[model samples]
Structures are given as structure tokens and as C-alpha cells.
Target chain A: MQPVIRLEDICKIYGMGDTEVRALSDVNLVVNTGEYCAIMGPSGSGKSTAMNVIGCLDRPTSGRYYLDGIDVAGLSDDELAHVRNRKLGFVFQQFHLLPQLSALENVMLPMVYAGVSSAERRERAAEALTRVGLANRLNNRPNQLSGGQQQRVAIARAIVNRPVMLLADEPTGALDSQTTQEVLNIFSELNASGITVVMVTHEPEVARQTHRIVWFRDGMVQHDNMRPADLAQMTLTV
Target chain B: MNIIESTRMAVKTLTANKLRSTLTMLGIIIGNASVITMVGVGQGAQRYASQQFESLGPNVLFIIPGSEETRDRTFQVPRTLTLQDAEAISSQVATVSAVAPQLQTQQPLSFRNRQSNSLVMGTTPDFLSVRDFGVDRGRFFTETDVQRNTQVVVLGSDVARKFFDDTDPVGQQLRIKNISFQVIGVLESKGAFLGNNQDDAVYIPITTMSNRITGNTSPYGTEVTFISVNARDEASVSAAEFQLRNLLRLRHKVVNEDDFTVRTQKDALEIVGNVTGALTLMLAAIAAISLFVGGIGIMNIMLVSVRERTQEIGLRKAIGASQQDILVQFIIEAIILSALGGVLGTAIGAGGVMIVGAATPLKAGISTPAILLAVGVSGGIGLFFGVFPARQAAKLDPIVALRSA
Candidate 1:
């Protein structure tokens, strides 16, 4: 099976001349459909930069980036946005739901951008919230919801567009251990349903829950490992 | 994003910051209201002045004597107008309806012992019709009185009231310049014309003033100060003016500029209209500056809003909103603010006009075009000032914005 996202020797640099900083240096990455992968790295290891490139939020300085065989390096900002909208969804550490909007409205946001009719957008957003166990909190604003509920709403918003992959950057960073496990279960269920998931995290426990892990040091990948079924079951029990 | 969704989001955001939005709208409201009110007042004043001019009778002409240079050098009054000229215009000129010669002088008026300074005008009986004056009491002096140089006077309504109180003054004696004359009639109250109170004066025969009062004689005939000619109607006014000017030129042998100026009531109104129109425009412009300031305030607030919503913008962009979508959202927000302000301002402005009309001598009128202009300008201010902040929001990089979150 082809990889859903494929990067060949990607490089992204910041500044120039004597002040150059290589945020991503000769990075190669792949995540196949239906796989749950976690990228683990210390601070300043270019993990977030790699996520940005994969999310189509930024272009690589040099090197090819292919998502479902479409080269995104040369795509214009609007075209990149189109690709991001149709193929990938994002859940951020801060649970970046618009404060003014209710959970239902926040979930409907992606469909709104996709030009879905209001009636259809509401129906799909309702279904997405139901899937995230937030059916009772649809009309509640971000402030009205708990940190866990808000993140769940963010997750619902990410999947409402029915994108091919979910890209989570520090998804549980702002959550407590209980809420973190609840969110991880949702991610696991989504991946079990054949949706590709790529998450960026620094916590060893969070990394252990994923099916595969890629470790980064500085700007390059230092190790890649797949968890055996026994190890995955032991990690889940812990 | 679609316009409906963008507008919905904009409204939600604005409502979330109700106090700030309401305060910002106040500036535009005051600016637009004041603009409408001031323009209405200025327009009302112009209309009032024109109405006053129109009340003086249509197509009537004024003939004032004495050239600027000649009057300054000689310091001597010219004996130009005579009864012969008045007769010539009245009978010979087909367009002339009536000709009334006037002799004006200041005099101390006394009824018994009560005395006051007043203008004494000597004119023919046709003065009543020609000058648009109505008799409120006894009859005016007749052509017979002009021929006889009668020592009878007509008191204006105010003069009659001052001298006689409640007593009828028609058959009473009134001393003018120490000359006792029987009051033959009481003229109607013709309110102030061009600042001079007409109801405070008295009128007599022009011949009586030349022969009995001033006592200045010329070999040609009794000299008159001025001649007021009334045309039959508006259509005949110009013809009468043309004929009279030619006749006067012939009589005075005016080879260069005439020793007189002829003006119609319309011409006077036009001059008044120009002055008031310019004043209205200037006042409207000043009010528009305040509107511009209000627009800037909106822009300032919107810029602050963009800064505060950086994460929200990034999220929207990440969710696939194009830059144009963000731009539309911000611009639509501004337009909604300004449009609401404009509607509020129009209501306030109309109320202000009504208040002025009720409280002051000024007649405040609401002009539809002025209201439309005020609203249009307000919307334009919104669009113009909204561009910079909206562009800034649109140009933000989603990566940087998301990182900031």
C-alpha cells in the first residue's frame, strides 16, 4: 500500500548567511493509511516544523513533499489550503476553538469553509460531536466547556470535514492524565476505523501508545520503531 | 468561506465585544447625525430667505440713482426722476402696470406730546399695489391727492398703534417734522423688508414732500429720489425693465455705465442662495471630517481585533479559508458597524432637526438627498478605513499564527 504522506529528503531553513538556522535538515518521513504514528523529539528537534510541512501549513525550503501523489512544494497558498481542507485535519495543543462560537459552531467551521449548506453542516457537525462523546455539549461555548470537553470539540472539528488523516500537535499537552487517556482512546478508535493518524509528542508514555514511533534529534530522524502487538497491549494496560 | 458564514462569524465577534463596538459606533452616529442636521438647517435658511424674496412680489424691479463716482465727488443729489418720467412709464410703456415715485426723509413724528423718530415716505396711491402693501385701516391717498398735493398722511399699522393706542387715527392729527397733518388712512402692517421696519413709517403724496416739505425745486419739474415700477405680471417684468432702462438712458444721456442699477427680486434671491448654499456645504464638510475620524476609530478597533484573533484566523486558515475569505469577513464586519451607525445617525439627525424646529426660530427641514449622502459617506468611510486592517489579517501566515496560539 502506498503511503498517505511521503517526504523525500525535505529541508527547511530559517534566515540566511551567518545567522542561518536549519529547522529541518534532510528529513524523510512516511505514514501509511490507517497507521497511528507518533513523532517524539526533544525541544528544538524540528518536530513541529516537520508537522507544519506535512500539514500543508508551510512549504519545505527545498525537497519534495508528496501527499497522495500530489506534490505540495510548488502549490500556491490557496491550493495548499485546498489540499489541507480536503485531505488533512489538525488538533492543536491549545484546543484552538474560536471562543465566541459554541462547540457545534466550532465543529461546523471546516464544513463552512468547504461551502457545505448550513443544514448539512449542522447535521455532519452533530454526528462528529456524537462520535467524540460531546453530543450533550454541542451548544456550549469553549469557555463553558471543561478543558477535556473543549479538546474533544476540537477533535470533532478536525474530523467533521472527513479528511483522510488527522495531524495532532501536542494534543494532550494541556490536558490532565485522565482527560489525556480519554482523548487517546478517541484517537485509537479513529485509527481502528482506518483513518491515518500522526501525532507529535515528547512524553514517553504518549509515544508508547502509538503503533509506530519516529524519534528526532536536532533536525534529523535518529530512530524509527514499530510496536509489537504484545508491547502495544502492555502499554495500553499500563 | 461563504458570505453568510463569514457574516455570521463577524456578527458573533462584534456581539462578544458589545461595549467596545457600541462605543465605536457612537462616533459615527454623532458624526452622521450632525452632518444631516447642519445641512438641513443650512438648507432651511436658504429656503426661508428665498421665500422672503418671493413674498416681495415676482419680477419687480428696483431703480436706484446716483453713480458711485458722481455721488462721491459732487455730494449733491441729482434731480433725475420727475412726475413726467413716472407718467411716461405708466402710460407710454405697455408692460408697466403701475409707477410709484418715492421721496424718503427722516422726521420726528408726534401725536399730541408723544414723539418718536420715524421714516416719512411720500408716494402715490399706486404705492399700495406696486409695493405689495395692503391697507389695514382707512383708505390710501388717491390720484386726486397726488394732483392736489394734499396735506394728508397715511400711518402704518405700527405708527398708528404707537400714536393713537386704541383710538382710531383715521381722522386724527399727527405732526410730522412739526407739520400737523390729518391721518387720512392707516396702512397695513408690512413687516420688516430687508431689515427696515416698514410698519414703523408713514406715507404721503410725493408732490406734497417736494412742494411742502423739502422745498427743493428744479426748472424741469419736482425731482424724485427714486421710482418703483411694477409690471403687470412676471412675464411682463423684463419687458418693462428693458423699456424703462432705455427711456432713462435717453433722459439722462447715459453714454457709458448708467447712473442707476436695476435688479429683480429673483436676482437678489439668487445671491442669497449662493451664500447660504456655500455655508451649508462648508458645514457638511466639517461634519464629514468627524465621520472620517469615526472611520479611523473603526479601523483602529479592527486592527486590535485582528491582533487579538490571530489564533482564530490561523485556525480558520488551517481549516481551508482562503485569504480572500478572511478579508471578506473583516470587511463585512466594518460595513455592518458603519451601516448600523448610519441608520442610528439618520434617526438622531431627524430628531435633532425636529428639536431645532420646535425650540428655535430656525425651520429645520429634512432633505432626502442629504440623508442619503450622509449614509453613503458613512459606508464609504467604513470600506476605506477597513482595507488596511483587513489586508493585514488576510496576509498573516497560518504557521506563525498557529504557533502563536
Candidate 2:
């Protein structure tokens, strides 16, 4: 089967001459539809750079990136934004929900950007919040909710547009262990529903729950491990 | 972004910081109110001056003797106007309504034992009509009385009130400059004209004053200080003025400059209008400065707002808001503030005009064109001052902004 995301010798460099530093060098990667993958690396290991490139937030220095068989490097800024909105959902470490908006309004943001009608956007946002087990907390603002609930609201916002894949950058980095486990459970449930999930993290336990793991060191992939039973057990526990 | 969604977000953000919003709006409110009130007061003064001038009548023309150069010194006095000259103008000048040759002197007049310092005006029967005076008690001196140099007098309302009191002054003997004259009539109350109290003056025959009172005979002709002529209407005023100037010039036989100045009511009104109009414009201009200061206030506050909401801008951009969306949001906020101020200013200005009209002799009229211009200029100020800060907000890099918090 064709891969959902294909990165061919993707390279991202910062600065030039004596000040030059290569964040990602000749990296090739693939993730098929319905697969859950985790990218693990140490600090300054190029994982974040790779994630930024894959998320269409930044272009590669010299390489082709294909998402669902569409070339992302050639698209303009606005066109890339359209692709990001339609095909990828993002969950950031800070849970960047607008503080002035309620949980439901935050969740409806992606659909609003998608140009969905008000009635339809509200309905879809409600469904997304319910899926994240935040049905009762829809009217609450970010400051009024716990850290876990706010993160869940962010996740609901990510999935509101029904994107093809979920891109989480340090999803549980700011949460307590218990809240982290609860959020992991939500991610596992989403993965079981057949949405492709690609998470970037440094934690081994977080990586152990994914179907495949790609380890990076000094801007190059070190290993790729596929552990089917571990992914199965993680989904079953959630 | 759609305007509705942008406006909703703007309102939400502004409401979150109520104190800041109110403070920002205060500048605009005060600015608008001051502009309205000052301009209204200025306009009121202009109207008052014009109305005062209008009460002097529209058809009357004043021809004062002596040029500006000879005004202070006693030169050869002109003897151009006489009783015959007044009669000739009345009959020959087609546009001339009436001619009242006047001679004025300050003297003491007495009736019975009552005496008062009063103004004595030596003029013909036509003076009553030309000067907009009417006899309240008895008939004015006729042409026969003027020709005969009759020692008959007419009492002004105040003169009658002071010397005659409740007693009848008509047909009674009154002593003017110690000369007894029969009171033929009582003049109506004319209030005041050009600072002279018309009600305190006594009217006698001009021929009597030139022949019997002053006792002077000119080498050229019978001399009079000034001649007052009334035109038939507003349309005939200019024609009568032209005819009188030509007639006087021909009679004086001047090879160069004439010694007399013929000033029409319209000339006086125009001078008054120009002076008042200029004053109004200057006041309005000063008021506009305050509006500009208010705009600057808006700009300063908006810059602060942009700084305060840096994180908000980042988050919105992250959620897919375009740069244009941010620009539109900030610009709209400024426009809303200024437009609100304009509305408030208009109301304050109208109220100020009304208050001035009530409190003083001036009539304050609310000019619609001025109001529209003021509001439009204020809003334009908002839009102009709002652009720089809005652009600064829009040009902020999203990544840098997100990292700022």
C-alpha cells in the first residue's frame, strides 16, 4: 500500500558557512495510513525540525515531502496552510487554546478556519469534545479548567476538522503522570479509530505505545523498530 | 476573516480590559465635546453681530462729509447739500425713496420746570419715514413748516417721558437751547441704532436749525453735516447710491477726488459678515486641533494595546488567522472608538449652541454642513492615525510573538 507521508532524503539546514548547522540531513521516512509512529531523539537531535517540516510549518532546505501523495514543498504559504488545515491536526506542548474563548469555542476554531457553516461547526466541535471525554466541560474556559482538561480541549480542537493524521509535539510534557496516562488513553483510542498518529517525544514509555518507533541522533535516523503486540496492548488498555 | 467574526473577537478583547477601553474612549469623548462647544460659541457670536447690524434697516445710506485725511483737522467745510439738494434728490432720483438732510447738536431742552440734556436732530418731515420713525402723539412738521423755518419740535419717547411725564407734550412750548418751540408731535420709541439712543433725541426742522439756530451762511450754498437717504427697496439701493454720488460729485465740481463718502447698508453688512465669518473659521480651526490630539491619543493607546495582545495575535495566527485579519480587527476598533466620539461630539455641540442661544444676546444656529464636516474629519483622523499601529501589529512574526509569552 502507498504510504500516507513520504519524506525522500529530506534535509533542513540553518545558517551558512562557518556558522552552518544541519538540523536534518538526508532523512528518508514513510508512515502508512492507520499507523501510529513515535519519533524519539535527544535534545538538538533534529526531531523537532523533522516534525516542523512534516507538519508543513516550514519547508525543507533541499528535498521533496509528499503528504497523501501531494508535494508540500511547491505550495505557497496560504496553500500550505490549506493543506495543514485539511490533512493534519496539531497538539502542542503548551495546549495553545485562546484564553478568552470557552472550551467549545476553542474546539470550533479549526472548523471556523475551514469555512464550515456555524451550525455544522458547532455540531462537529461538540462531537469532537465528546470523543475526548470533555462533553461536560465545553462551556469552561482554559483558566477555569485543569491542565488535563485544557489539553483535552486542545486535542478536541485538533480533531474537529477530521484531519487525516494527528501531529502531537510533546503531548504529555506539561501534564502530571495520571493526567498524562489519561491523555495517552485518548490518543490510543483515536489511533484505534483508524486515524494516523505521529507523535514526537523523548520519553521511552511514550514511544513504547506506538506501532513503530524511529530513533534519531545527531540529525540522522539511528533505528526503526516495529512492535505490533505492544501497540495492540496499549490500545486494549485504553 | 469575515467582519462579523473579527468584530466579535475585537469586542471580546476590548471588554476583557474594561478600564483600558474606557480610558481610551474618554480622550475621544472630550475631544469631540470641546470641538462642538467652541465652534458653536463662535458661530453664535457671528449671528449676534449680524442681527444687530440688520436692525439698522437695509435701505438707508449714510454720506458723511470730509475725507479721512481731513477728518481730524478743520478744513474748508463742504457746502454741497442744502434743502434744495434734498428736494432735488427726492424728485429727480428715480430710486430714491426719501431724503432726510440731518444736523445734530447736543443741547438742554426744558418743558415747564423739567429739563434734561438731549440730542437735537434738525431734519425734514421725510426724516420720520426715512429713519423708520413714527409719530406716536401728533403730526410731524409739514413742508410748509420746513419752508417757513417754523420753531416747532417733536419729542422722542424718552424726552417726552422725562420733560412732559404724564402731561401732554404735543402743542406745548418746549425750550431748546433756551429758544421756545411748539411741540408738534412725539416720536415713537426706536430703541437704539449704531450706539445712539434714538429715543433720547428731539427732532426739529432742518431749515430752522441752519437759518435760526446755528446762524451760518456758506460761501458755496447752505451747508449740512450729512444727508441720509433711504432707497425704495433692496434692489434700488445700489442705483440710488450711484445716482447720489454722481449728483454730489457734479454739484461739488471736483476735478479729482470727492470729499464725501457714500456708504450703503449692504457695505456695512458685508464688512460685518467678513469679520464674523473669519472669527468663526478661526475658532473652528482651533477646535479641530483638539480632535487631532484625540486621534493621537487613540494611536498611542492602540500601540499599547498591540503590545498587550502580542500573545493573542500569536495564538490567533497559530489558529489560522491571516495577517489581513489582524489588520482589519485593529483598524475596526479604532474606527469604532472615533465614530462613537463623533456622535457624542455632535450632540454636545448642538446642546452647546442651544445653551448659548438661551444665555446671551447671540443666536446660535446649528449648521448641518458644519456638523457633517466635523464628524467626517474626525473619522478620517481615526483612520489616518490607526494605520501605523495596525500595520505594526500585522507585521509581527507569528513564531516570535508566540515565544514572547
Candidate 3:
């Protein structure tokens, strides 16, 4: 089967002249449909840059980025935005829900940009919020909701367009331990339902929850390995 | 995004910071108000001027002593026009109807106890028909009064009221420059013209004026201040003017530069129209500058708003918003502010005009074209000034924006 995302020899360089910095270098990776993966690294290890490339938010200096079988590395800014809209969903540690919009309106925003009709946008946003267990808080603004609820609203927004892969950067970094568990459980449930989930995290506990972990050090991938729990459970079930 | 949705979002964002939005709209409001008000006042002034001119009688022309250049150069106007010239035009000019010669001077008039320093005019009985004046009581002096150089005087309504109050002043004696003359008639009110109360003046015979009052300063026979002539019909005004100019030139004898000027009512109206129209344009232009300043204010605030909302822009872009979406949203916001201000300013300006009309003699009214133009200009300003900031917002990189946030 074709992988949901494929990156080949990706390199990202920032600035120019004496102050040049390499954010990502020669990174090749692949993740199939329905796979749950974690990108792990120390500070300045280029994990965020790799996430940005995978999310189609930024282009690499030299690379091939194939999202859902279409090469998107050389696309124009607007075309990249279209690809991101159709194939990728992003969740940030800050939740990033618009402070002025109600939770439902926040979820409906992507569909607005995507040119969805008003009726369909409303209905679909409601369904997405229900799936994220934010049906009761649909009319609440971000400031009116708790951290976990706000993150749940962000998740609802992310899945509102039904993107092919969810790319999260430190999704649980701002939440407490209890809220982190709730957020991770939602991610796991979403993944179990066959949506590919790729996350970047520094915490070992969060990394261990994923089916696979790719470690990065100094702008390059160091290891790509499957989790022990997934291996043992697969062996027992088979 | 759709226009309606963008407009809705713009309104929502602006209402979220009501004070800032209101302050940003203030310049446009003041600008539109001033423009509309000035246009209405200018139109009112034009109407008032025409109304005053209409009171001067139909198909009337004025023969003034001295040319425009001579009048400008000399402090005291030269007494070049004479009573014989007026009589000659009355009898010889075929298009002429009647002629009234006037000699006006300001002097003290006194009754038994009251006194007033007012204008005293010496004219013929033709003044009643030529100037469209009506005598309220008693009779106007005839040609006999002029030939006899009688000192019988006619008091205007206000002058009569000032000396005699509600009592009749006919056949009463009044002193002008300490010389007593009997009041033969009291005129009906003719209202004020160009700030001078026409009803505050008294009238007598031109012959008496030259003989008794400011005794003939000119060597010319029966020197008159000016001659007012009526045309037989409106169509004959130009013919009458031409005939009178030729007659006067012949009477004056061999003049390259004619000593007097003959002006029709149309000429006076055109000059007044030009002056008032130019003044209106100047006032409107001054008001438009405030609109431009308001537009610049909008641009300034919008740029600051874009900077403040950089993170919001990033988030929207990340979720698939195109650059056009961002641009439309900001531009719509600016339009909403300016358009709203325009509507409010129109209301205020119209209300002010109505109030002024009620309080003053000016019949000022709301001008529709002025309102439409002001609103259109302000809205266009909003759109024009909005582009720079909106483009700045749209060009922002989501990655850089998000990182900054």
C-alpha cells in the first residue's frame, strides 16, 4: 500500500552568510496509512522543522515530500496551503483556538476557507466537535474553557476537514498530567479509527504510547524503531 | 471566503475593540459632516441671494455713475450720470418703461422726542413702480413734487415705526438735518437686503435732494447717485441697455471710455453665482482633506492591528486560509468602519442644517448629492487606504508568524 507520507533526503537551511544554520539535513522517512508515530529529539535537534515539512507548512531547501502520493515539495505557497488543507491536520501545544470564536465557529473556520457551504460547514463542525467530546462546550469561547477542553476544541478543529494525517507539535506540553492522558487517549482513539497520527514530543511516556518512534539529533534522524508493546501484542494476537 | 462571511468577521473583530474602532472612525465622521454642512450652507446662500435679487423687480437694469475702473480708483464715486440723461432715456429709448433717479445719503432725522441716523433717498414717484415698493398709507408724490422741489418726505415702515411706533406718521412733520419736512406717506416693509434694512430708509424728491440736502456737489445738472430703469418686457432688457448706453455716450460727448456702466439683472446674477459656486468648491475641498487624513488614520490603525494579530493570521493560514482570505477580511473591516461613519455623519449634518434653517432666515436643507458624494468618497478612501495594511497581512509567512507567536 502507498504510504500516507514519504520524505526523501530533506534538507532545510535558515539565514545566509556567516549566520547560516541547518534546521534539517538529509532526512528520509516513511509512514504508512493508519500508523501512529512520534518524532523525538532534544532542543535544536530539528524535530519541529521535520514536523513543519511533514505538515506542508514549510518547504525544504532540497528534498522530495510526497503527501498521500503527490509530490508537494516544489508547490507554490497557495498550492501548499491547499495540500495542507486536504491531507494534513495540525495541533499545537498552545491549542491555538481563536480567542474570539466559539468552539463550533473555531471548528467551522477551516471549512470556511475550504469553501464549504454554510449548512454543510455547520453540520460537519457539530459532528467533529461531538467526536472530540466537545458537544456541550460548542458555544464556549477558548478563554471560557479549561486547558484540556480547549485542546479538545483544537482537536475537533483539526479533524473537522477529515485530513489524511494529524501532525501535532508537543500536543501535551501545556497540559497537566491528567489532561495529558485525556488528550493522548483521544489521539489513540483517532488513530485506532484509521487516521494516521504523527506527533513530536520530548516526553518518554508520550513517545512510548505511539506505535513507532523516530529519534533526531543534530538535524538528522538517528533511529527509526517500533515500540515493544506493539511488537509483543502483534506476536501474541497472531 | 464569501463576502458576507468576511464582513461578519470584520464586524465581530471591530466590535471586540469598540473604543479603538470608534476613535478610528472619528476623522471620517467629522470630514463628512463638514462637507455636507458646507454644501448645504453654500446652496442656502445662493438661494438667499437670488431671492434678494428677485425683490429688486423684474427686467430692471441699473445705470451707475463712473466705470468699474473709475469707481475702484477713486474713493469718492464721480457724479457723471445726470437727471437729464435719465429723462432722456425715459422719453427717447423705445424699449424703456420708466426711470427713477436716486440720491442717497445718511443723515440724522428727528421727530418730537425720538431721533435716528438713517439713510435718506431722493427719488421720483417712478421709484414706487421701478423698485416694486407699495405705500401702506397716504399717497406718493407725483411729477409736480419733483418740478416744485417740494420737501414732502415718505417714511419706510421701519423708520415710521422707529419714530411714531404704532401711530400713523402721514402728514406729520419730521426734521432732517434740522430742517422740518412733512411726511406724506409710509411704505410697507420691504425686508432687509444684503445686511442693510431696506425699511430703515426715508424717501424724498430728487430735485429737493439736490437743492436742499447734500447741495449739488457736481457742476453737472441735478447730479444723481444712480438711475434705475425698467424694461417694457424681460426680452427687451438687452435692447434697453444698448439704447441707453448709446444715448448716455452721446449725451456725455466724444468718449472712448464711457463714463458710466449699464448692468442688466442677468449680469449681476451671473457674477453672484460664480462667487458663491467657487466658495462652495473651496469649502468642500477643505473638508475633503479631513477625509484623506481619516483614511491615513485607518491605515495606521490597521497596520497596528495586523501586527497585533500576527498569531491569528498564522493560525488561520495553517488551517488552510489563502492570502486572499486575509486580505479580504482586513479590507472589509476598514470599509465597515468608514461606511458606518459616513452614515452617522450624514445624519448629524442633515440635522444641523434643519436646526439652522429653523433658527435663521436661511432656508438650508439637506443636500442629497452632497451626501452621496461624501459617503462614496469616504468609502473609497477606506478601500484605498486599506490595501497597504491588508497586503502586509496577507504576505506574512505562516511559519514565521507562528514561531513569533
* lDDT agreement of model 3 with the native: 0.89
Clashing pairs in 3: none
- Positional deviation of residue A2's Cα in model 1 after best superposition, in angstroms: 2.5
Highest DockQ scorer:
1
lDDT-based ranking, best first? 3, 1, 2
Lowest summed lDDT window (length 10), candidate 2 chain B: B68-77
Which of the predicted structures, 1 or 2, would earn the higher DockQ when compared with the native?
A: 1
lDDT of every model, 2 decimals: 0.86, 0.81, 0.89
**How does residue B127 of candidate 3 score in lDDT?**
92
CA displacement after TM-score superposition, residue A58 of candidate 1 (Å): 1.3
lDDT tens digits, residues B207-263, model 2? 898887776556656667778889989888898999988887787776777777787
Q: Write the per-residue lDDT of candidate 1 for residues B1-405, one digit (tens) a residue.
A: 777888898899899889988987888999999998999888877877777788878957777666656667676756766766777778888888888888888889998789998999988988888888988788898999889988999998889999899889988988988888889898777787656899999999988888888776655577777788888889988888899989878877789977765667877788889998998899899988888888999899889989989998999899998899999999989988987898899899999988887885567799999889889988888888888999999999998998784
**Per-residue lDDT of candidate 3, residues B159-263 (tens digit):** 999999988899899999888999999988989987799999999999988889989757668899999999999999999999999999999983588889888
Sort order, TM-score high to low: 3, 1, 2
Colliding pairs, model 2: none
Give lDDT tens digits, candidate 1, residues A91-160: 9999999988899999999888888999999999999999999989989999999999999999999998
Candidate with top TM-score is: 3
Question: Share of real interface contacts recovered by each model?
Answer: 0.84, 0.18, 0.62
Worst 10 residues of 3 chain A by lDDT: A229-238
